[model samples]
Target: MFSKLFKSQSALRRFYSTATQNLTEKQEPKTYYKITLLRSAIALPKRYKDTLVTLGIHRRMQTVFHPHKPDIAGKILRVKELVQVENVPASAVRTKTEQRWERRPDPGFEVVGTWKNKRWLLDEEGI
Candidate 1:
């Protein structure tokens, strides 16, 4: 049972890894900007709010991906104190739905050894 489970897990991992590589290759460049809003612009100057708007960040914790360019870099610098910025590949970017899905917790338990795989408990002394 354990072997079957392991084999399935490995297959899933392989499939996802290759799929991820394809996705990245098709959508992302070697380098890009990952901008996440860490602080809100409320009660701040108009410039900060305008900058955030220009960067396409609407609220706190919102993340936006942009290409690495002089104009974008300058905008980031201008609002450096209000946001967290990182250089990431296009593959790292996630849409709103994807981000929400990723934030969800796992269901907890999973089936492992089954009746057909009694060999999984071979080393156990008291079964």
Candidate 2:
């Protein structure tokens, strides 16, 4: 019985170590980049925002990667009036991208629903 228990314990230890290794392996190394959102697409016509969106940027602070090319550099310069470009590591860029993707939806819907239901019920009861 003791030998069986020892074997089981060893199995458990191996399983735990394998699970930890799997977790570590799934983690992506971070990528960072210098980013700038060159256009005030918000102020420009919707076409500009659509163009920026096509380029993988949406909101004002949104950023996308472009290998340093003359065309990209030129676009950055044109948008320089609106955006502040900076050099950053690929890892930092990856972290920021992950963070933006992981962001939760706004709580406004739940808040409005609760408030409307509570207010309606209270009014109906003459409270």
Best-performing candidate as measured by lDDT: 1
Question: Across residues 1-127, which tens digit of lDDT does each residue of candidate 2 receive?
Answer: 9999999999999999999987765553323335557446666767656556545666666666655567666666645566666654344455455767768567575432256469766767789
TM-score of candidate 2 against the unseen true structure: 0.39
- Candidate 1 residue-wise lDDT, 1-127, digit = tens: 9999999999999999999989968676657788999989899889989989999999999998888899999999999998998888877877778989999999898865677886557536445
Score each candidate by Cα lDDT.
0.87, 0.62
List the candidate 1 regions with Cα displacement exceeding 4 Å.
Answer: 1-29, 108-127
How displaced is residue 30 in candidate 2, in Å?
A: 15
Q: For every model shown, what is its TM-score relative to the native structure? A: 0.58, 0.39
TM-score of 1: 0.58
Best by TM-score: 1
